[model samples]
Structures are given as C-alpha cells and as structure tokens.
Target: MRDTLRVQLWPLPTLGVALAVVAGVGLPRLDGRIRHDTPPWLRDYLFGGSADAARSVLAAIAGSMVTVTALTFSLTVVTLQLASSQFSPRLLRTFTADRYVQTTLAVFLATFTYALTVLRTVRTGEDGRTAFVPQVSVTVAFLLTLASLFALVLFLSHLAREIRIETMMSSVHTAAERTVRRLLTQRQDPADGEPAAGDPPAAPPEPPANVLPLTPGASGFLTSVDEAALMKATVEADALVIIDRLPGSSLIAGTPMGAAWPRTGEPFSPAARSLLTEAASEAVRTGPERTDLQDVAFGLRQLTDIAAKALSPGINDPTTAVHALSHSAALLCELARRDLGPRLLRDDDGQVRVILRRPDLQDLLDLAVSQPLRYGAAEPAVLARIAMLLRELAWCSTPDQYPTINAALARLRSTVDAQNFHATEHGRLTELTARVDEAMAGRWTPGRTR
Candidate 1:
C-alpha cells in the first residue's frame, strides 16, 4: 500500500499544485473583468484587513506548492534513472544529462508563482470591492497545463523506445547482409559452379584389375594399356621404346626389345642406363606414397558426395556441404603440393601442368582420387573417364594443349550425360572439370579462356 501511494502521490500532487497556480494567475490576466462582483462573506474571509489570515493562506499555498513540486521533480528524476537502467547505459546518461529535467522544474516554479500572484490579487480585489476570481477559467487552464505535461512525458518516452528498437533492427540487417555477401563473393567455388565450401565427397570406383602380373621384371614398372598399339605408338613417338624380352633372360638396361620391335637393340650410354635404373627404383619405392594418395582421394570423393546430397531435390544443407567441400579441396591441394611439389601446382594460363617425368605426379593423382572415393561411391564411368583424360593432359609439354584435352573430356561427358549412364558420376566428372578449370584460372578467378 505504501509503495503504491508513494508512486502515485508524486505525480498527483505535482499536477494539483501546477493546476492551482496556473488557474490563479492566468485566468485573471486573460480576462480583465474578473475583479467585479466579489461576495461579501468571501471578501471578509480572504481580505477584510485580516493580515494574519492572508499570511496564513499564503503560507499554506506556498507550502503545498513547494512539497508537490519537490516530489514531482524527484519522482521524474528517479523514474528516468530507472528507465535509463533498462535501456543502453550510454543513452541513459545522455538523457539524464540533458536540460529536460531543468526545464520541467522551471515550468513547475512558474506555475507556483502564477498561483500565488492570482490568489493575492483575488484577496486584494475583494478588499477593494471588485470581482477578482474567475473560477472556471482558472480551473480549465490548470487542467490543460497538467494534461500537456503528461502528454509530453508520454510522447518522449514512446519516441525513445522506438529509436532503440530501430537501432537493434538495423544492426541485425547489416549483419545478415554481410554474411550473404561473403557467401556470394569470397566463399563460392568457381570450379564446381556452386557455392564454395558445401561439396560432398566423390564416391570411390570399384578397384581396377591390379595387373601386377604384367610387369614381372623386378626393375620394370608395368601399367596395363588397353590399346597396345597406342602404347607402342607413344613409345615410338617419344623415342623411349619399351621392349619385352624373354622371361628368364637378363636384358641389358638400354636394349630396346618389345613385342612391336623384337630384336634386342644396342646398349645405351652409362648415363641413360643410370636414369632408367633410377626411374625403376622410384616406381618401386612409391608403394607407401600410393597408399597415402589413395587415402586422400577417398576423402575428397566423400566430401563431393556430401555436397551432391546436400544439393539434391529434397535436401537443403548447402552451407554445410560447401564447407566440407572447401576443406576437402584444401586437403587435396596440400597433398598435391607434398607429392608433386610447388612448381606443378601453380596455375598457369588455364592449365595445370603435372610434369610426368617427375616421379610424384602419379602419386598426386592417385591420392587425389583416393580422397574423393573414401567418402562415397565413384562418379559415373564416363565422368571418371573424363577425369582420367584431364589427368593425362597434365603430362602435356605445353599449357596450350590443355584446351584439346578439355574438349575431348567435354565430349566424353556429354556422351555420358546423353546416355544417362552413371548420372552421379557424370555430374562429379563435370565438377572435376570445373575444378581443373578453376585451378588453371588461379585461386578465385573462373571461366577458362583457353
């Protein structure tokens, strides 16, 4: 009860006193004829030369005005302070430090002075036998002033609340805009033609026939070729022919003898023999590196799969998928760098050069494919074939030759798409092409002119 009263009394008293004062002074000033027809009894009570009564009346009015004014000001200050606590501390400080409080106080004092003057005039007018009190006008004016002050307080408070809300909304808007911009610009994957960072892993292909039997010689590295004629052609064109000798015979290192060219050839120079030996040794020693590459490729493939799944018709997890894709790409790049070295990794004129003469290119490609497959199943066969083509192009002598490889891969991809064979693989192969293109274009730049 006390608390409720405490809260109510301050505003109530302020209103009452302010009304009384404004009524007393303003009414008579606006109406000049208010001093006539004063009642005899009221005149005697107020001003029939009774100085004590006048002094007592004056003192009562002053005391009431002072008490109400002080209470109102204190309440206003306290309320503002509490409100400030609820809002931003900085705003509260500014509001409190403003001249609003002082202005309110000044208005209150003016009301008190006006009331005193009007009351004194009424008493004096009664003694002089003239009408002084215009009760209706005085009451109306007092009520209007009180109403205005209340309205003003309400208006200001409401305005402050709106400002705060707007500020909060604006901040939220800016943050959202910034996030969208980053996703659109900096984080997108130019290669895959999708937003960056949300790609699924590529699925693994079934293990190919491990034709370890083909290369029986301990020093001869054997890789099966579907086109024996093509393989022979390549060997002949490059002047690095591979000759197949009798299983039990120890052929000279530099002798050129194969199914295509049966007779044993003249021996090579010591340096050439040493180079072949080194190449054979490196190939044999690549077992651990191949395993590592396989692992990395498997991981990449999985990430690509996730990205594809996220982008599927019923799914909507693009952001998550994109993040995975980015991570996988970064890992793949690192692995490539470790195996192939920095020179081969550098993007140069829309082509990724993998100098096959260097021992690490095979390891890098193996790893790249392995990582992708670890996460999911392999892409379509056609796509896989296209990727193989691209990998082969990396062995080309010049960067300009990449376009020919790209065109061939594109045709292969189109054929696979048309056939609807291994749809997922086809899509993955397309994505791989895009990645190669992006890599050739440098970090973020896309659209390979070559």
Candidate 2:
C-alpha cells in the first residue's frame, strides 16, 4: 500500500481538489459577512468590480487554469515516454513520485476548481434580489492563478533537468542506497541467524518428509512478505515456513511459492494444514511489477538495464555504460560490507520459524556486473571501469566474502586475457588485477605499474 501510493500520480492531486472544494464553499460565506465591513484602506486590496465583472474574471481564470492543467498533463506523459524509451521503464516510478510534478498538477487543478466553484455564487440585482459579489474569493482566485502560472514555469525547468541522464541515474542511486540500508545489516553473528562475520556459513536446512505446499493467491512478481504475520501463524500452528521466492521473483497463481511443516518431527492435521495454507497465501504479496520495498536487487537491475541498453548496437553509448558501471560499483562495495544472507524470523523462544530467501553477494555481483561484462567487453573504457569495480569490492569485502570477490575477479581477468589489446591496455588491466589482490590482502599499492 505504501509503495502503491508512492508510485501513483493521483493521490496528491485528488487531495488538492478536495481541499479546493471545501475552501470554495466556505470562503464565500465569510465574504458575505466582511464584503461591506472592510476598512477604508483594505477595500483597495479587495476586488472592486460589479457582480457581472466578478463572474467574467472567475470564468477567465477557470478556463485558463483548465487549459494549463491539460498542458501540464501532456508534458508529463511525454517525459514518461522519453524515460521509458531511453532509459529503463522502472525509472518511471521516480518521475511519477516526484513531489514537484504532483504539486504543480495539484495547484493547477485546485485553482480551476476554486474559480468554477466561486463563479456560481455571483449575483446581480434582478427579480428583487440585491446585487452581491464575493470580493475576497475573487481576489484569492486571482492570487491562485498567479501562483499557478509561477508553478508552470518552475515545473518546466524541473522537467528539463529530470530528463537528463545524469539526474535520472543519481535518483536511482539514492533510492538504491536507501533500500540497502533498510534491508541489510553490517556483518552480524551467524549464531543470531544472520550471515557470519568471519565464520563458515551454516548449511541449508533439509526438507521435511511431510511438507504442505503454500500457493500464491495471484500471479505476479513477489514484492513483499509479511514476516510478522507469518511468524504469528507459524507460532500458532507450531510449524516452520520456508519461503523460497525472493522479492522480484515471478509468481504464478496456484503455484507452490513456499512450504510449511510441523516444527516438531510430526505431520500436520488436515484441518490445520488447510488453515496454514490460507494464512501463508495471505502473507505473501505480489504485484504487477517489482518494487524496491524489500528487493535489494531491483536497483541494481535498473542500473544494469540502462548499461545494457546503452551498449546495444542501436544505442552504442559506451560512455553512458561506463558511468552506469561506476554507480553500480559504489552500490556493490556497499553491499559487500554488509551481510547478504537469507533472513531468519525467530519466535519468542528464539527458534527460527520462518526463512526468507535473499540474494547473497555472489548473486548480486552477477546481476550487477555480468551484463556489462558481456556487452561492453569490446570497449576498453568499460572493461577498465569493471576492473575498478572489482577492486573496490575486494577492498570492502570480509574474509568470508572474499571467495565471491575472487571469483568475480577471475572472470574479469579471463575477459581481459581473451581480448587482443595493445601492450599498454593489457598492462593497465593487469595492474588493476594486482590492485584487487593487494586490497584483499589488506594492503594498498600506490603507483602505476608503468
């Protein structure tokens, strides 16, 4: 629900419209009491026009505001299209969640609604009715029109900057960092159900003979899992639930997403099994697409998509790919310093009741580096960036995580060895590999090999 509201464009604007309606209805009543009681100097600030003139002004403001609102919507749609076509479609969320765009739309629509609402209260001396005009309401509407015009200019400038590639990548990087902080922790003790700081990892749990399959309610990417609710259900049924699907994995309706079994060495009763299945299905949430709520890899995947698309023959933007690699490397280094292991949810007794799968360092490394390594192999600059990336990761990685870094480093070395480069290019890459070795050995070597 939180992710849905964040990526939507309507909630804020609808709120603005609702507030405008309330203000429009109530402000005129206040104007009726104060229209004729204004101080001598204050009267100069209020609308001094006749009822007919007030109606004309209100109608003009209403018409212009609605027209501008349409224009703003068109520009927004164009921006979304450009982002989806040029960058990854996942970036659309960044734009849709922009407060500036939402605020601009809200201001415009609110101004239009207010003006139209106030226009109906205008009266002229006819049929023995006294002529009356909402002086303060008209002035407020005019002020809103001015504010809307200013917002229009600011929105245009903002849209211009947001469409740039650098701005888009930075936005993605910031979001990814937040996700990393929220979902991962600095190397923790394995005894506490976290990835070991320097200890040998625990072995995977064996499957029970009598396990009950838990199917999803619908088909989509698994966005989140309600661990607390799962823990409650697990404790009540005295069972252990293992969810194999990570966030961003595709789920099919009626397919086994996970399994549950009695925590004790016993089988579940038929009635208890049915109840467990229903609760498990409700605990896992799926959506039409992936969200960064709990998916650490979603950010990396978006950056990789940009790099991959840039390297495509149609685009052939190696410089962009290199920049994307730089960002990916920073995120990878951050991930390396943390524990990337499956999450274990324990109950009050401290026994693990739920196991949620998460990507390890090796999996994230492949996701972040493999595509660029494949597509950007021909570009020396890109290869150098990838080499630098591995070196950075090696420096931050713990000893237990060293094997994964070394494996990635070996692949980088193999890629460079296969390339028929000049002596200078080959030598530079060799120096980079040496630096990775030095980093892993807890040493820093400063100087060019040349």
Clashes per candidate, residues 3 or more apart or on different chains: 54, 0
- The CA lDDT at 444 in model 1 is 35
Q: Estimate each model's TM-score.
A: 0.23, 0.94
Candidate 2, overall lDDT? 0.88
What is the Cα-based TM-score of model 1? 0.23
Evaluate model 1: give its lDDT: 0.39
Clashes of 2: 0
Range of the 10 consecutive residues with the lowest summed lDDT in candidate 1: 285-294
Give me the runs in candidate 2 sitting further than 4 Å from their true place. Answer: 188-204, 447-450
Query: lDDT tens digits, residues 13-117, model 1?
Result: 456467657656666675455435556655443333243454455445555556756765666566556434432222332333334444455555555565466
lDDT tens digits by residue: candidate 2, 181-216: 999886553465433345433544666866899999
Provide C-alpha RMSD values for all models, in order: 29.8, 3.0
